[model samples]
Target: MADQHTQPAKLYRMMMPDHTCPYGLKSKDLLERQGYEVEDHPLTTRDETDAFKAKHDVETTPQTFIGGERIGGYDDLRVYFGVDKPKDQQSDTSYQPVIAIFAVALLIALGLSWFAFDSILTVQAFQWFVSISMCFLAVQKLQDIESFSTMFLNYDLLAKRWVPYGKVYPFGEAFAGIAMTAGALLWLAAPVAIVIGGIGAVSVIKAVYIDKRELKCACVGGSSNVPLGFVSLTENLMMLGMGLWMLVRLLG
Candidate 1:
């Protein structure tokens, strides 16, 4: 049997005057990692790269050939080496993107609070974190209201009955968030938060726990892959807390 390490892999990648294809370097590294001796072919100019692509009848660069067979691009190379590309990048059922947005919003909230009050952890900072996170999530929903409404109707009892509630929900969430962030319009923000949050909590619980229906969450957006359950429930609970707190402060 021939040694796999002795097998040569041919790689054609772009190397121009002003740009170098990063995927090409990645492919080379992967090939080496897989114990293959790589024959690097650098297309040094635009015309050269274009000509090579034309000859190979392929559209993209960093093409790989192993054992006298075309192995496609960087993703294909990973597949060949049995390396799993991130599921979030290729699959639809991933919570990583929503998690990332919340993570960033938390950091921003802490930074803003520290700059304004000289403290990273405080009641006001926590409020800001929830408010900003709400706004961010609302924006995602607003990007595709139609899609959001469809997904929302699957579980939200109010959305299923009224239908327009799905369309109006994002705007209401955004308005509540903005009002809370500014520490103004407590009358409007508090009621809006309480009503929406209450309904959302009940709807989520019934769908996930009672009916045992597994579904996607529309908290981050209509198209999000975040599962509809714990995270969604937590979001509603946070809103409830914010609303009650604001209402108490106003009353006191």
Candidate 2:
């Protein structure tokens, strides 16, 4: 007898840019074998796609919903249905950005140290710290990969990578912490520098979107794991002012 374990008793609507999808077929086959009502929605326009999501409360393509709870993108649901290995079971995902960020931060730290020795608490020292810290923040960006995946991948390894309702909460919290710290540090050192940092910070804050929280953050090269939240607005604004101040010097 065919293995009865692989099927999901759910409704799945597949959205695609084109009809040819090898990955989706494999997913659909798996869903069908499990007794799912798989509906293929051939998207011809952005408006039609938007209509589908609104009708179904679907935030993700290849959306797999079980009794209305979005199980997630189909592949992750497969794992949820025992189709793939548990995420933690996999090896530490290569934290490529963490490694790279650390290297870059090291350079910034060195520069900061050099400036500190030359003068007692000057703008140059503060600037070095801000530069290195921005690079250091690449750690968060690295961890934000699960967030990155949602924008491109059909299958999600972590939790729901793309949801239409709200993903900004986490990104807001994280960068806020860094920005607050950066801005406060600069505020103490140089008032002008904080203004420049503020602009970039605003750009980052504006970049916050519902898609940003698609997956759990794998911080510090996957060494740290924490859920994201929205209380970060305060700190992020602070960093925004300081970082923007320093940045303006570069442009002008």
Candidate 3:
């Protein structure tokens, strides 16, 4: 067999007037980075690209070929090079999405407070931050209610008892969040927040502390890879605090 270093890998990529295929560029770079010489084949026109695809019996561009073997696209190239592509895995639980939600909510609240009251650090800002976060979290759950309910039922006591509660939970959360955001209808929002938050806190505590069951949290939504533990506990506690704060303000 010929030495791999002397032989160049063939790369067919699109280089059109309006669009240059990003994956094609990436494939070229990857091959170069892996110490392989590349015979770059740039299809300059749409028709040319289409003809190349038809002739090769491939559906996409950025196709790589080495020693008469097809190596597929950018993702395939990574796999062949023994590189791991980023994906959500149970072993690699992340809280980045949850953190980002809260961070952005706080910034938005701060901006609103500055515009309305000429201040960022205020009770209203805190309230808005929490309310916005609730709505965002609810949106995540609502996106795939089926998946959220399944994960929720694993730990949520109420969801386990009343199967329908899992489905209704997102709606209730959204309603509470909207009401809280408006700073109106305390009678409706406060109770809902308190009831759900209280129940969630208790359930999380029981599952994590009492039973010591290791599971994933559906807090950021059903598809999240966040672990069921302290972060989840903190979320429930924040809701409880918001509910209590609203109640005290309304009563006082």
Q: Each candidate: what lDDT?
A: 0.89, 0.47, 0.89
Any idea what lDDT model 3 has? 0.89
**lDDT, model 1, position 3:** 64
Superposition error at 67 for model 2 (Å): 3.4
Q: What lDDT would candidate 2 get against the real structure?
A: 0.47
Which portions of model 1 miss their true places by more than 4 Å?
Answer: 1-9, 12-62, 66-70, 80-92
How do the residues 149-217 of candidate 3 rate in per-residue lDDT, one tens digit apiece?
Answer: 999999999999999999988898898899999988988899889988899999999999999999999
How close is every model to the real structure, measured as TM-score? Answer: 0.78, 0.28, 0.73
Which residue pairs does candidate 3 place in steric collision? none
lDDT of 2 by residue, 1-252 (tens): 154334434444444565544554666777767766665444545676678678877675656555546666666876877767887786543445545654675566566657658544565555444445543553454565555434312212222443431233234334533544354443333333243234323423443443454333322323333222221232235355544564564446
In candidate 2, stretches whose alpha carbon ends up further than 4 angstroms from where it belongs are 1-23, 35-44, 54-59, 93-252
Candidate 1: tens digits of C-alpha lDDT, residues 117-203: 999988888999999888888899999999999999999999889999999988988999999999999888998998898899999
Q: What is the lDDT of residue 246 in candidate 1?
A: 92
Ranking by TM-score: 1, 3, 2
